[model samples]
Target chain A: MTTSKNTDMDPTAEPEEAAIAPETQPREVATIEQRAAAAGERGAAAVADAIEQGEDAEKAVGVLYLGIDLGTSRTSVSASNGQRETIASYVGYPKDAVSQKLLKKRVLFGQEALDKRLALNFFRPLEHGVLKSSEEGTPEYEDNLRAAKDLISEVIRRAKPRKDELIYAVIGVPAQVSINNKQAVLDAARESVDSVMLCSEPFSVAYGLDMLDDVLVIDIGAGTTDLCRMHGTMPEDADQITITFAGDYIDNKLAEYIRETYPEAQFSIEMIRKIKERYASVADEVDKVVVDLPVNGKPTSFDLTDGLRAACQTIVGPMVDGLSTLVSTFDPEFQDRLKNRVLLAGGGSQIKGLDLAIEREMATRLGGGKVMRCEEPMYGGAGGALKVAHDMPAEFWEKLK
Target chain B: MTEMTTAKAPAASALSVAQMLHLMRMEVDNAKLHGYAICCLMIGLDEFQTQAEREARRWLMPAIFSELKAITFQQHIRGLGLTREHFILAVFPHIGVKQATELSEELLAKARELELPGITGGTPVTISVGVGHNSHPRSDELETLIEDAETGLNLARSGGGDRWMQWRTVEDELEDIRGELDEQIREMRELGPGEESDAVASWGHALVRKIVDAFAVVEPSASLNQVRSDVLAIVSSEVDRWRDLATIRQLSEREKTIDLLERRITKLTGSLDQTESELKRIASLKAIDTGISSIYSTVQGLLDGEDNTEAKREMLKDIFEANLALRQ
Candidate 1:
């Protein structure tokens, strides 16, 4: 029988670097081609191992792996077929007969739904990073369930899976999603994929980056900021936290400041969102934020730099406070390692100067620290989830299916 | 006589003219943001060089600086500065003009009350005070903030020494802004008993009112951008529907009003675009756009020794446990 290593070992075991601990050294360089070849070799080896373990090896050939980050604002997917897609997580149905006739479609998705919302019954199925599971038997709850299913199916369809291929998906969820919520997500995803598993969003990010240990992952999505500390092991309940102070909160705060400062100007949440996405920062010298809103039916310009900065700064204190708690409570030997490997992921992580701000806070609050921004803020979770789907063994897939 | 070169706590704590200017500029933003008030007070000892003895000036200067610094400790002052014969004090989180005036009077009283040895009687070493504060924080009247203080000082000195005066801007800025808004509303209303422009006027009035209502609550939770965009969407759709109606009938009056309303709508949309570009400019200040792409298409094992696999798996299990614990 073929056996694979399953014991804790130094990740950096190459003889040239044997003396250095894995967490202290930079990751080894592997070219894209090299990594791909290794992955292909591993895939074949894993299949052979499965066969020896009395599993069906032939069933794996046409199986596709999908990693999905189902978020409140946007749903992103990275698939084995080399397709990555992100869409606004919204679904809309025609409001009435006349509008239905005009739109010529029963339902719309993403930006289309957002644009045509006036004539459609718009639904955002997820809120704060979970399926909006309302009280059962209520129409609102049923509608949310339907919307959630439709949204998942639509996102899968966007992956362009071949009809002959079996689909296996791993979805990244909030670190502390309820069991009922996970079941609801699994139920929604099962309709479209052959097998599915849910993983913590931050864990998925860490897995994707190959920083599985001695790292603190902060995935700041629209609805929540999830913090996870990895110590060469999967993070435990004590190693994670989910705070609601995130992108959505920043948007609301920015909008509020604009409203108060320019009482004669008219604006909307979408506009405020644009402001947050484009101009959000917590730095000493960010450029001026000036935008125009209609006033007395005339366009008037107002500077919003102060308000945007203030709103953006709101998350820093809370996030650093959370980071302090996570860092202080870790094994004292690994606490410094955890602080030094702070990883920023998710859409909210795209806010400018946030990594530096967090790092600065960490130094003051935790004695000293380091923070690294994920190369892909928008797709970090989705990419990590995809990695999870790929790493999952064939037997787990079969069992889950 | 107080020693001129002697460093007292308040005068020693004083920043340079440059530093004080910088601090005032920084605090102006905070004052504007939190809806508080700030004012700069410029006090000049009236013609000290020509009036007092060169030896007397050394002791007199420190006495003047000391008293000025002492007054700031009594008020909500942010910083105090000395430039030659003049002293500038910046007061912040200001209560109002009345409080500022009372504080200014106290400062003047304290200056005249100073016990100077070189000069006697006739309100020895009289000082002229000038104060300037803004009612609206958004106004960039900062360049003239110091100038206003200077002007008020000039007025105080000209109107005889030992007195203080507050500068009143020649034009009422808030009133001017209101007048401009009213004028625009009047012009839009003048579009006259027509359907398209009237609808535009109605939406316009409603939009303005909504903006006004937004000012009542400045909570970060309130999303004014959403309200603005929603109103714009409605107005734009209405304008589109009206344009189609006018196009089909070719009613001259309807077309004319539609044209006028369309221009207004275009103007409104143009401002949003300008605002977007402005926001973009701010965004460009940071390294935000260069999002890094991950190289790994699939999950790869850690670069660990063979012996560590079990520990790695154990960690993964712990993560699952933490995640699962949420259900519990």
Candidate 2:
């Protein structure tokens, strides 16, 4: 793992640097390669320790490690050792002279690559509920795959898996990724990871939460909206549906509407996104405030009370309608109970009035039920992956990515 | 400034004057994207190059500085360094991307030549100049005049390239853009004697009257765009068969339902319960598509064709299949 570029700084670390933390003040003519070799050794030691912990069979420590939250908007990865994270499911490039010089680069990804957003070109890797890909000969082809690869690679880098450990990653694919899409994700992940196993994102969330018995998991993020009905066993395809309208949909609609009303305002794909995250509210607010909007070269404030209210409430109706449909798919005996337990996860679930809004709409549909938000914000998916790793054998784990 | 004059000259490079304008617009737009405000435009001229038949140029080739300096004799004028943030130099590759490069000195000389207010020159004035804001944010017409020096230099040279030119204060030129947009909107209101009238705008004036007389409420998904589309085949064909067309009234009703559906969509994003409702809705809609198409078409065929009981019975079976699929 010691890259050629690293040895010129540590010529003599090649011999004595093999020991722990002893590379400092060694040979006079050290080359970069020797230093790089030292770095690789340290990396190897960390992996050995992580792998040892993963192999633990006792209740306190299980060597099997995992990370997953197959998301509607984006997928997140976490390991048993508490490393890794979320990857934005988008990729794009600058289009024209304006965009080319401004970005100073060709392509961008995740939150960064929103296409030629600066009046140039832009593309999203996942549109609606499926992979956003086109025929290889088409112009839109390589971009989406490139983004997915970049995202997976970034997640693996975050996990910091070691060379010797039997690295296994069980990634949660969208319930809608289709068998074909799941296979594609696994193939894409093959390069950065040792092995791959695909699981339904929603079910993975429920299993992570230990709510497999009579529960529902709704993972809402920037990309898509997903609902999973969980029973004692792994949920089936009939139990899930990925909706196109999620956080981004609302943001875009708001942006379109706002642009017409305030034509001079300089609205961006990012600022509006941050604004949605910051102040988008559905439930009745205690403190109503006007947001200052940048219009034409100046700042203009508008009473966003009604606009925010309407925009935030946009997803509520579809969610309720979907929930009502999902409940009927449950066992006849648990129909009423399923109505009582709803679990909301993912970033969009963090909206202030989200649970209350959901519960209100649901109560009208199902007579009454409790809509619950997950406590963990960033780690639920990773936590779930870790849980899976703890029980499964290392070899089985290696099959998942 | 009567009718403006542009001396049409074949461009000295592939990047024509229009291309330069577009490029500047793009750059400004890009800079604005990074949240930067650029409120000025500046151009400089190299008059000596304009005069000589074998025009020698400076500001680009530094390795042959002695050769470049020979062409720039009016080096008597000394100056201050223009800041980078306020400046963007668009000279040839002979100069390169960096101002520190060799070919950059000619542009640098011209920029430095212009002191705080202005710079004076002798009769050897070689390059015709134009100075105006090429749509840079902070410019008005006066600043645009400064920018117009490039255009003037081109016009002076009969549309050849401009030398050192700078856009003066553009407080006035920006009004032309605003005025243009304002005129467009005003024209949209049907102000002129000969301008074409817009029905959408003309009819919208009497708000309450327009509502009372409203005849069409277009459907959300049903549009002229849906005419040749296969996605609407069943829906459109059913309309043809049953004569239960998607008329203005039904379209209005559909629009209302669609609006209602959007609210439910918003509600559904936060809760899982709405999933069932959505599925049910889709199922019902799909059923409606099948029924309205197959049943109406089948009955119409039976009535128009054999006009027999047996044909009607077969039609009933077809209707049954469509109904069963929808109900499930």
Candidate 3:
């Protein structure tokens, strides 16, 4: 494929033909809002400033398209107004009047909430691609729903959309999410955006890369590992497998083993999660995993190399097991092709040597296989969802609105 | 709180309205950049028009203005100016219209106690102050802001000079409304979908729609629905495909056992080797560790047809079947 950048007008070109070309575009003021949306971080202050520069202060026109990946552990967004941000899937509300006054906020989000967790009633709204409290008509469920909505809105606002601009967004959820959960996601988004749509997370990843044929996308999320087979079409449920032995499971397993080895060691799930994120590998040889934890109120270093590796390796069994099933059942003619194009995505795929480990596992059990990790694991789903939003026809967007 | 800075006392002594405008602009600009509100106060000396009062004005005005400035300075008011017969003050850094009203009330009370020299207690230099906050003051909008403050001063003078009055410009009022709407939107988001009372939620929905319409967003929901329907259609087709595939049972009963036998043998041998190594290490080093290493480095659960491994195939089939059932 040849890449072309148009610089000048060809006077002799056929007028009608050139008019229909996808390369052609209409000229406009190229306002700061447009440029910011294109660049992606344009926030409220920036929008306020941009609107001040408009020729007509009363009317500034723009559209901000957002693609959101609402994961269990982290929420990510890519906006047309050139903003991209990710925050932990955590929400916090001040415990009482004193804390509220001290914090100077009624509700806190993302890292701010995590840092000030002691004064907050913390809630993580998502679990396994849906609201943790997705049940009907309960206070806890309502509270969690609120948290999810706030988190979604916070991520969207992080894009810094102009109040004058239309916001249309597409969100990616787990491929097999229930209709009710999908409805909840849609409802949450409706308040924050003009129109919204939902797509399968793994499919969005595939769509983002334009890899629609004979490809296997294994998205290892915090709560689940989703394996989707793309054979030049929308993958059916039979072609996708979701297993729960993912990032969170690895964290818990690592914590369990560490406790067994160092009974007196003081640690938290949060601490273990950080350690895993920093140094998770399933390889036989790894750098020395030395970490310090309090034991009897004294900090001590422990050699947890084996424990970490063992914990990281636990997911390998279930993932490969699922991969093997998807591969064997595919059309026999394209089975080899599918085996050769395993694309690893999601936060869990960030584990060092994971692709290699999966590859090795595939070869030993399934004749031969290849595994490749996404370049930007954390943003892959969001990027894909954005692509889906971009490629979706105008009619689809209109119908949703 | 009578701690007026000696340095600023000279500036307010004979400051012109033009000089006051320039200084007020700088202070307002700084406050705007830091997201703080600043209020402009226009105070008029009530009975300075009579010939006798005019003769006493020069000495009486400075003393009264100086006293007022001194009183405001103690309250941490940031700027002060005197323009002809009008005394102006800019109080800043988060002092909104509400706080500005309170400051005006306090100033009026203090002005009544100021005993003008050569006048005894004859009217006591009762002054009226008009207060206006520089709301949403863009660079060009500062001139309008000063006019709005002046209008407030005129209102107080007409309503009888002994009282304090405050007014916000129309633009400032709109900005306040916008701020309130934004805050409401934030609260609505915090409430989540379907959790808020229906009436409030409905209003939020309508507000969001109006906002979207104002932006002229082209709706893409129909296409979005189309894409969703396509995904659902694929699901239906695949289900039909699975039904066709399910009817065929390829592997023989004998083949399934052999596959299971191979796995059991591999597992037992690996465990035996691991036990031997652990024992040797403990005997030699006297280490008291009980960490069990996993046996298979790579997954051996797939059916590699060369070994006629039926059990692994069965496992894959079972998993696939379970997934299919779940989808159904």
Candidate 4:
């Protein structure tokens, strides 16, 4: 199943060595012919299993598995067909006939929708890593529901599933998402795939890296930061923590700082979001973050280095607090182990020197701790979900279908 | 009856006079298509008092033809041939009435310079030329133009043998107005930028007044209200057509922007796909565990192994149970 042996590294090794060890591991020595032969055998075995379960031979020939991380700011997918894709969580419809004719499309997705938002009825369907509207049958709810369905279809289409293949997907959502929201997600995905499942975002990140035991996963997403503690079994609600101090929180903070310091500096939330993504850091020393903002219709440069650092630093305290809660609540014997094997992941974790900053915070608050950033923070959740999809038994998929 | 023999004219270059006339007809038609003027000149020798004098002049005809051909070539005119024993015809295309008149006079002067041998003494040959000019010839006007030149030739011969005359028609007077109008339009176009609007306005007012005056004169019975309405309708339609053209230009600009956006989107999408593939390749190179293989198989394989089997089984069971609850 391609389990990650990163957690099996020496406990006494330097944190840097431990972090770099996983990437420098020697590749498996299987030849192309050997891998192909093994894959063929697996395919045959799956076919036999499917046939034994009373499925048609044609349906058993191919199955396309997908793992999806449905985040508030972005949606990502990892497909068994060696396809990976991510897009901004935006969808739009042309506002009028003129716009429709000019755009030559009835609907637009992601950045295209965002770019031509003035001519479109734009919707960002998810907030706090869940469907924005929970009240069923409302216009807003229906609109968000439709947008989410279209987004799921788009992400699935990007996977390029063949016509002959049966599609099974596992989606990773926020750890503490309500039942109704999970159902909403399931409802959206059902229209696009034959079978689907939902799992916690932090759990998926941990499982993707094979850190299922005595590891703490902090998935810092745009809408919410999910911290889930794994102890060799499925994490219940008690094992998870969700916080609002994530990417969007940083953007709002930075915007507030800019408004207070440079009152005349004109900027939109979208611009602030882009600026935060580009220059976000919690470190003391960072390059001067000079950004151009229009004042009286003219571009003016404003140095936002301190304001940005302050904004980015805001998420760290809440994140470590969540970590501290998970660590304190764990068994006494494994409390230090959980703190040492912390896995920092998701889009918000891409902030420069974030792991070290979190480690520093942990040292001050919890004596000493290690924070390891996942190599592909943006894709970690999706990759883990895909692994879950692949590992799911055929009967479970069939029953879901 | 004596049989008439077809004589090849020196200007016709071995072609019979009939063939030369056919070629002239074709050239006239071509000139009409291009809105060019065609001028026909008919030159005849002065009347001979005696048969012996006429015979002597007849022998000098080829030399006279050669001199006229040289003059035509020098003036860049072509399509010259002999139509009768006493007459030489020359066709010039793209020449205006004034230029053709000058050329006819030149031909007459050049012909008078020739001295031929006579019974009494060396007498200078005298000739008269008739010019027919059509500034905008129609395809069927070739025969009429030739007849007009013939009439002028007869008139010249009747008046004086050594003079030249032009056959003018009502069209020639209209040609003056056409030339003036074209010049005014060109001048208006060439006016300085700031002066253009005023010039165009004045020109438009004059044109509208001219049209109203023409309607009043041409249709005395028509009501003034009807005429005013007709003029208004014409102006409105022209304005509407210009407005439509402007709208089309705006639409075209918008379409270009749309096309640019579509191209940018396609390029970005391609680059994104490439980056994803590259990341995957890098992951594979680093032997990063993607966990793509099925865990069901992994669990079954681990059943015989002794490496954390109980914990692995319990973890798998937990994942299954959670997924089951979600699906249900």
Task: Compare the candidates by TM-score and give the number of the best one.
Answer: 4
lDDT of 2 by residue, A309-392 (tens): 677788988888888889976778998888878999877887788899899988887887888888764455556654443433
Q: What share of the true interface contacts does each candidate keep?
A: 0.08, 0.00, 0.00, 0.06
Q: A1-401, model 1: which lDDT tens digit per residue?
A: 00011111112221111121112123322343444355588765654564565522222334556789999999987766566777888889988543453354677788778876876899999989987756766788788888988888877776766555678888999988777788778778889998777889998899888887789999999999999988776666898999999988998988788778777778888878877888888888988988877888798888988899999999999999889999888889888888889999999988888988988888888988888999888778888887666655555566566
lDDT of 4 by residue, A1-401 (tens): 00011111111221111011121012231233433355588755665565566523222335667889998999988776566788889999987643453354778888778877876899999999999985988999999999999999988877766655678888999999888899899999999888888889998888778788899999999999999999888898899999999999999999999999999999999999999889998877788999999999999999999999999999999989999999999999999999999998999999998999999999999998998999899789988887667666576677777
Order the candidates by DockQ, highest first — what do you get?
Answer: 1, 4, 3, 2
Over B1-328, each residue of candidate 3 has an lDDT whose tens digit, in order, gives 1233222223333444334445656666777677677776666777577777766554544555565566656677655454343344343445677777777787777767766446644666677777767653442234445555665666566656887765454335445545554554455456432322344435545654564564455556878657656655665565555444432322233346446655655565555555446435534543343211111111112224423234323422332343334334
Highest-scoring model, lDDT: 4
Evaluated with DockQ, which candidate comes out highest?
Answer: 1
Interface RMSD of 2: 29.2
List the candidate numbers ranked by TM-score, top first.
Answer: 4, 3, 1, 2
Shift in Å, residue A81, candidate 1? 0.2
Residue A116, candidate 4: Cα error in Å is: 1.0
Task: Pick the winner on DockQ between candidates 2 and 4.
Answer: 4
Q: Chain A TM-score of each model, in the order shown? A: 0.84, 0.74, 0.86, 0.86
Q: Per-residue lDDT tens digits of candidate 2, residues B1-328?
A: 0011011211223443234545445544554466433322232333443433112222211112222223222333211111111122232111112221222335344333322111123222222223333234444222232334333333333334333333232224334444554554454455233212233223334442443344235443566345425434544454344333334445566567656655554444433334335435534742342100000000011122322335333423332332233223
TM-score of each: 0.50, 0.47, 0.51, 0.52
Measured over the true interface residues after superposition, the C-alpha RMSD of each candidate is 23.9, 29.2, 27.0, 29.3
Q: Could you give candidate 1's per-residue lDDT for residues B233-255 as a string of tens digits?
A: 77667666665565455557656
Docking class of predicted structure 2: incorrect
Off by over 4 Å in 2: A1-75, A92-108, A111-122, A134-137, A163-165, A256-266, A397-401, B1-328
Error of 4 at B272 (Å): 43
